[model samples]
Target: MTLAHEMAFASPQITAYAVEATEYPDLARRYRVTGVPKTVVNEHIEILGGLPEDAFIEQALG
Candidate 1:
């Protein structure tokens, strides 16, 4: 989540959101979020767990 905020801060083109699964049950179901720290980029790229900064950037922007 920190990396996401940092990336958003670094690039105007990037936007990040942090959602609590317990709070937003419908959204969690929509995204099929089975774990914490799930990252969905543009509603297409679904990253299911924690990732290194570089690797995350590559997948997100590659």
Candidate 2:
């Protein structure tokens, strides 16, 4: 799904927060993010690897 579509259905008005690994070394360590494709959503939902567009959005939205 497109980011636009995800935004369309998102609650709490939908927001995306992005932080570079270097910017938050502590968080990176806690999350065990060693690769480039890791994705963590809301700090609770950790998607360890890349996924298809639809699947990624589904997880984030949930």
Candidate 3:
């Protein structure tokens, strides 16, 4: 969540959304989200679970 917030702060090009899986079943299904704290970057990059900051950033931005 912090990374999402930081991305929002660091770049105007990025848009961050937080959604409840139960409420947005279609979205959850689309992303194959089976757990909490999943991050879908640019609608393609799927980073599952909590990660160390550096590792998360690498997967997210790389």
Ranking by lDDT: 1, 3, 2
Assess the local accuracy of residue 35 in candidate 3 as a C-alpha lDDT between 0 and 100.
92
Q: Write the per-residue lDDT of candidate 3 for residues 1-62, one digit (tens) a residue.
A: 87888877889887888888999999999999999899999888989899998898889987
Q: Cα deviation in Å at residue 60, candidate 1? A: 1.3
Alpha carbon lDDT at 14, candidate 2: 66
* Consecutive 10-residue window with the lowest summed lDDT within model 1: 53-62
Better of 1 and 2 by lDDT: 1
TM-score of each: 0.93, 0.60, 0.86
Note the Cα lDDT for every prediction shown. 0.89, 0.68, 0.88
Q: Which digits, one per residue and each the tens of the lDDT, describe model 1 over residues 16-59?
A: 88888999999999999988889999998888789888999898
Model 1 misplaced stretches (Cα beyond 4 Å): none
Task: State the TM-score for model 2.
Answer: 0.60
